[model samples]
Target: MSMKLITAIIKPFKLEDVREALAESGITGLTVTEVKGFGRQKGHTELYRGAEYVVDFLPKVKIEVVVAEDAVETSLEAIAKAARTGKIGDGKIFVTSVEQVIRIRTGESGESAV
Candidate 1:
């Protein structure tokens, strides 16, 4: 079966809720990283018009999970539900196909690598 990698950029504070939701959806492992980025809203600031404006660097959390194709939709829904705060700067999610996976310790493949 094919596999997929789901990467979601969400507000830092919602990480815990996302983790819990994933676990509840039967996802056992994931990776999280702190990140900063800009989106459609672009950058905003307030100060002297003539001076150089420093763009605000918003704090975000990147969550990565690998799962079987069949599980992708559920995992995505779990993350979306858990991360949604109905506010700005919530971030985004991206999904991509994974060709292969290897476990460094045991050399496991397929779902085992997940």
Candidate 2:
């Protein structure tokens, strides 16, 4: 079976929802990172202690998952539904082909490694 890598960038507050959704979709494992970036929404201004500052990057959560090709659609739907807030900064999801996977300790490769 072919494998795929799914990457999603979403609002930090939506991480938990996305995780739960993925798990329910039969995706058991994923990697998450705290990230900062800007797109169409750009950044915003913050007023602190009488001084105003421009925030160029916004906090976001990056989620990465590897799954069999057959599971890709469900995974994408799960993430999109869970992360959507009907507003700007809801973020984006990307899917890419995976050439191979290897389990370091077990020496298992391909779909099994995933």
Q: What's each prediction's clash count?
A: 0, 0
Q: Which lDDT tens digits does candidate 2 get at residues 1-114?
A: 899999999999999999999999999989999999999989999999999999999999999999999999999999999999999999999999999899999999998998
Give candidates' CA RMSD values in order: 2.8, 0.6
User: Could you give me the TM-score of model 1 versus the true structure?
Assistant: 0.88
TM-scores of the models, in the order given = 0.88, 0.98
lDDT tens digits, residues 1-114, model 1? 999999999989999999999999999899999988778656667568678676777678999999999999999999999999887877799999999999989999877887
Alpha-carbon deviation at 48 in model 1, angstroms: 14
RMSD (CA, Å), candidate 1 to true, equals 2.8
Superposed model 2: Cα runs more than 4 Å off: none
lDDT of each: 0.90, 0.97
Q: CA shift at 14, candidate 1, in angstroms?
A: 0.5
Candidate 1 stretches greater than 4 Å from native: 44-53
Candidate 2 residue 28 Cα shift, in angstroms, is: 0.4
Number of the top TM-score candidate: 2
Error of 2 at 86 (Å): 0.4
RMSD of 2: 0.6
